[model samples]
Target: MKRTDIRKSVHDFVSLRLDDHQAFADDQSLQALGFDTQDIEDLMFRLEDEFDLTAFTEEEDRLLKEAVTVNDLSRFLQKIARH
Candidate 1:
């Protein structure tokens, strides 16, 4: 999928889960928006379904721990989508 599409999917999922329709700017921090472990798990499943791929591999899981913002995840997803 295209990067923009991936970003949109990510934004849509996050917004839907949070019940916020506002567009998520690239700089926004999901953590600041109240994301927690459960939310991450939920998002992982949703993205896996959306993109037909796995997320949060053991390596990626470690990387996820440092991802504090939307852009961080967007880039991570882009990388996965490319491979």
Candidate 2:
């Protein structure tokens, strides 16, 4: 999938999960948008389902621990899709 499409999917999922339709920047922090641990996990599961990923690798899990922004997740998804 294209990077922009992945990014849009991320944004759409986040907005839908949060029940917020407001536009947010790629650099915007998920925490700042009220994403708790559970919310992040839920998003991950949703993304995995949407992208047909079996599961995240250990290295990817490590990176996910450091992810803070929408762009971070988008980048991660892009990398996963390429593999």
Candidate 3:
């Protein structure tokens, strides 16, 4: 829920390699950050591991494109953890 916690969690998922956190301030588009397609998979896996959530299916992965910020991704993961 807190933006700072969400940002921290996402940065940890990326292994802190997202070179442009400032530009991503309000955007969660992985392509905009130049993250390779598989990098997104890796991040999803990291989130799974971090929060002990089930893996997202291929369809769910595609849905992540709509998530546009660390906060968005965090909320997504929170939804995941809840169910």
Candidate 4:
């Protein structure tokens, strides 16, 4: 999928998984949506499988350390896709 599509999917999936409407691109702090660290890890795994990429070390770091927004996750995936 294109980057935009992936972005939308990430946002939609995050919203649905977290059961919140506040997971739009602008919503930072996914944890506020009830996504715990485990949930975030699961989401990253799902995204990895969906995108068909072998995750790098930075992927997890980025997800855990700095990916506060859906757009952050989208950009991370786009970065992985590019590589």
TM-score of each: 0.80, 0.86, 0.64, 0.80
lDDT per residue as tens, model 1, 2-81: 88898888888888877666666778887778888667766766776788876547746764587778777777777777
What is candidate 4's lDDT per residue for 12-46, written digit by digit as tens?
77877854455244457676677777888888888
- For candidate 3, report its TM-score: 0.64
- As a TM-score, model 1 comes out at 0.80
For candidate 4, the TM-score is 0.80
lDDT of each: 0.75, 0.80, 0.63, 0.74
lDDT: which is higher, 3 or 4?
4
Candidate 1: Cα lDDT at 68: 76
In terms of TM-score, which candidate is strongest? 2
Mind giving the per-residue lDDT tens digits that candidate 3 earns over 1-83? 44466567886665476665344553566676777657766776777677677845864576456555556566667667666
Worst 10 residues of 2 by lDDT: 54-63
For 9-83, candidate 2 gives per-residue lDDT tens digits of 899899996765778899999999888767777787798789886555784576458779988888877777776
lDDT of 2: 0.80
Clashes of each: 0, 0, 3, 0
- The parts of candidate 4 lying over 4 Å away from their true place are 20-23
Alpha carbon lDDT at 2, candidate 2: 84
Off by over 4 Å in 2: none
Most accurate candidate by lDDT:
2
Of candidates 3 and 2, the better by lDDT: 2
